[model samples]
Target chain A: MMVTLNDARRVIAAAETKAQEIGQPSNIAVVDAGGNLVAFARMDKAWMGSIDIAINKAFTARAFDISTEKLGELSQPGGQFFGILASNHGRVMIFAGGVPLRKGDEIVGAIGVSGGMKDQDIALAEAGARAF
Target chain B: MMVTLNDARRVIAAAETKAQEIGQPSNIAVVDAGGNLVAFARMDKAWMGSIDIAINKAFTARAFDISTEKLGELSQPGGQFFGILASNHGRVMIFAGGVPLRKGDEIVGAIGVSGGMKDQDIALAEAGARAF
Candidate 1:
């Protein structure tokens, strides 16, 4: 089935809370198993172009089945595609803050937050994810 | 809820299987609730230009709360200033083949695939998504 609106609201709520707690604004995105967007939020003071980055992060996570942060890890100099994403379309954000969603061991969707420091963004996303 | 690691694996597995099944090499992307890159794969014969499109599809999914196909639909005619949006950094592939993830009634993340015809790509991605 498609990702329901209810989950989209939850993701946004959690993102807001985490962002507020961190005192950092961000752009949050949520999509379904088919990689379709279900919800999104661009908080005040968030980065202008971050929406693209956030979405890319989430997309990367779901597409590769790994953490965007990990992509950063592998991106270290030469780890395969390292920067290949950038070369491909130039919107790859290997930094932290992008995460995935699941239902009983199934990655039904994902979330991406942008604007704050990569580490902080990741922490906030993780916090929000755990809350659900 | 977050797109769990399990979801990433499923996305990748399904993508690869579908690509092979279709006799088409493809680039697939999956993002988390946070819009992070969860999983990605570039089939041996997939077009290099397609990777970014695949990931962007997933990213857009998480960022816009809509389908890339729908986004394309909006780009047509004068729906919402159409072409004006393309000015925003432009890598917008409003084509199909991108879908989202959900748990019950929540959108956890999304998935995107590229390389084959847009419709075929979306169909393959959908096949993979349903497998989950």
Candidate 2:
């Protein structure tokens, strides 16, 4: 089954709560298994630039079936997965704050958060994923 | 004033019902005022390639604050807005299946439908926009 609207809302709500707790306004995006957006929210005071970044992060996580932080590590200089950033119309976001939503062993969707420090974004993303 | 998750889901639900009535599986996309995806749905058996088309249609409608069919007419050869497809990285979808979602005089978002004939897509898109 695909990621339903209910699942997307749950993830967004959790992410919003986490971002509020961190005192960092954020842009949150959720995408289905096909890397298509399911839900998105731009919190008050969030960076407009982070809107695309958040969506791309979710798309990248769903496309690769891996956390973006892990992708970033593998995409570092001299790494095996390097240069993948140039692919997919340069939409592969190799950064923190993106994680797959698992149903059993299957990745049903992904959530991405932006407009904060890497660690803060990761925290909000993790909160969102945990809600799923 | 933004199109919330509730609004997007309601629109998608209405669009899905209309597509079902027409016996056509469809890909639906909803985007906020910033022309960023807020939600999307791909009905079972919908054409995978139509996913991007659905999204671009919504983005185009939101970006220009006009129905895609009107834009299509205006963009025809020798028309006032001809050759506009070469712009926006070819993401501008001038077709008959995209309409803006309005809140009073404000254009809050847009909905797009694809994976069917032009008329069917337009019907579903109109159904979605009316749900808002």
Docking class of 2: acceptable
Best by lDDT: 2
Task: Write candidate 2's Cα lDDT for A26-81 as tens digits.
Answer: 88988888888766777766787887899899999999999999999999999999
Q: Candidate 1: lDDT over CA atoms?
A: 0.76
Q: Which residue runs does candidate 2 get wrong by more than 4 Å? A: A1-10, A20-25, A32-45, A78-82, A106-109, B1-10, B20-25, B43-45, B105-108
lDDT of 1 by residue, A1-132 (tens): 345778777877888897888799888887666555777889988998999888877766666666788878888776876665655366566878778777778777777778888778887677656644
TM-scores, one per candidate: 0.52, 0.78
The lDDT of each candidate is 0.76, 0.89
DockQ of 2: 0.27
